[model samples]
Target: MGLPDYIPVKGSITFLGKDITRWSITDRAKAGLTLAWQLPARYEGISIRDYLRTGTKGCSERDLEESMDFIQMNTTFLDRAIDKSLSGGERKRIELASIYLMKPRLAILDEPDSGVDLLALREVLGLLRLLADQGSGVMVITHREDVAAGCDRSYLMCDGRIVLEGSAGAVKRYFMSQCRPCDGCEVGEVMRRG
Candidate 1:
C-alpha cells in the first residue's frame, strides 16, 4: 500500500479523528502513526542502541532495557550495528522494538510473520497484542492462520480486494474451506466459483 508514502491521492486517511492524507511522513510520525516495514532498512553505521534511543528521546536506560526485554532481545544486541550483521529474525525484533519505543497511536505492520521461525512468530504476535493493550491500533498484513488468529478481526483479500471480513476464526475457516487445493484447483478460479 502507499500509506507510508505520505502523499495525497484519491482517498483520505484519518487517524485519531484527524485527516492526515496530506501530512508529511515526519508529521505523521510526530502525530503517533508509524509503520514497521517487512524488510526494514539497514543502518550500516548506527548501533541498535543509538537507533532506538533516537526514537525514544528522554527515555531512561532502564526504559530502553525494558523495551528490549519486552521483545525478547538479548542486551548484547544493543551494541551491534543494525546492518547485515544481524539475522533476519534479529532485524525484525529490532524493528518491532523501535515501534515499542515510539509508542505510536496506530501501527501498520507489513507481513510481520515472514521469514521468522515459529518461536519468533509467537513473540511478534505477543508484542502486537501488547501494542493493542497499550491503546495503539495494530493493522497486520499476513496470510498466516496463527497471525490472523491472534487478531480481533481478519480480512481475506483476493486480487487486491477484500472478499471476506469477519472475526478472525470465521475468516480463517472460510478461507481454508474455499481455498484448499485440489488436483485442478487454482486460487483465482476457486474464488470465482465460490
Candidate 2:
C-alpha cells in the first residue's frame, strides 16, 4: 500500500528472494519488480519505440516488432509519441508491450483488461500466459472474471484486505456469485454479507 510513498510498512515484500519492503520505487524497479498502471502515464516527447526500449538491453529490431505483434499493435505506433494522442487502450497495449520487452521477474499489472477490446483482451491473456510460462510471476489486479480465469491463482480483495484467494476458477466463482456489479455494490458491503 505504501509502495509509491516509500513509507515504512509492517509487511514483508520479497522479490527474487530478496527483501524489498522498504525499497524505493526505483530500487524495486531495478530489482526486476514492475507495476503497469491501470492508467498509464503519458510521456510527451518519447516515441513509443523509445519508451519500449527503456529497460530492454540488447533488444533487436525484430524483437521490438515481435513484441508489438504479440500485443497486436501495428508497427506504425513505434514512431508516435507516448502522449494524449493515443487512446487509453493504445497506451495500455504499449505499456504491456514494454513489459513484455522488459521481461521482469515480477509484473504487477493493474486492471490490464480495462478499456481493452475483446480481441485485444484475448491477445493480452495469451501474452500473460506466455509470460507466466516463461517464468515471470504476474500478479494482475482485476475484477473481470475472464481475466481471472486465465490466471493461475486469484486473490479477491475487499476493503483493502484480501478476503479470499485460491485457484483462479475457485476465486472467480466466489466473486461472480458473491459480488454485484462494482457500480451497483460496495465491496465492503459484499465482504460483510459474504
Candidate 3:
C-alpha cells in the first residue's frame, strides 16, 4: 500500500536512485528511501539507541542527541524499551526517528502521526517543516487537518484517487464547504482518522 499504486497486487516501487520494486524488502530499505510501517518492528535484544545506530552508521552523538530530543518531544517511549514494552505512540516515534535518520531525498510518511497525542503532533509538525526547509520533499499521507495544514501543499484523496491538488488552504475550504454544518464545522475534522 505504500507504493505509488496501492493495488494490493504485484507491482514495482522505486526509491532514491534504485528501482526497488524488484529487490528484496531488506535490500530496498538499505538503499535509502523507505517506509516506516504503521506497526514498528521489535528486536528483543537491542535497545532503542542501539537499534537506531545499527541502521544509521557513523551517526554523530550530536545527531542522536538531537534526534532523541526530537523523538522524546513527539514520543515518550523512545527512551524506553523495544521489548514489547512500549506503547503505540512510543513505537511510532521510534519508527519516525529511524526513517528521519535515513535522510532520503523524498520521504513518504503514511499516517505518520496516527497514534500520537496533541503535543507529539506539534513536534512532528515542526520536524516536518524542518525537513522541508532542508530541501527534502515530504509526501505525508494523512487525513489529519493539522498535518495537511502544516504541509507546503496538499493532495486530497477520495475513492483511492487524488480528487484535489492545491495549497492547504484551498483543500481545507473545499472540504469544509462540502461538509454539513459548514459554518460551525472544524477544519481539523478533515485530517482525523476513525
- The segments of candidate 3 whose C-alpha lies over 4 angstroms from its true place after superposition are 2-31, 43-45, 60-63, 69-80, 84-87, 176-194
The TM-score of candidate 1 is 0.80
The Cα error of candidate 1 at residue 127, in Å, is 1.6
Against the unseen true structure, what C-alpha lDDT does each candidate score?
0.73, 0.72, 0.63
The regions of model 2 sitting more than 4 angstroms off are 1-9, 172-194
Ranking by TM-score: 1, 2, 3
Over 77-102, each residue of candidate 2 has an lDDT whose tens digit, in order, gives: 88888777677667777888888888
For each candidate, give its TM-score against the true structure: 0.80, 0.77, 0.69
RMSD of each: 6.1, 5.4, 6.5
lDDT per residue (tens digit) for residues 153-189 in model 3: 6766543445677777788788777644324222232
lDDT of 1: 0.73
Q: List the residue pairs that clash in candidate 3.
A: 143-191, 144-191, 145-191
lDDT of 1 by residue, 77-181 (tens): 788887766777777888888888888888888778777888877877888888788877888876566677777777776543467877777776786788654
Residue-level lDDT for 98 in candidate 3: 70
Q: Which candidate number would show the highest TM-score if scored against the true structure?
A: 1
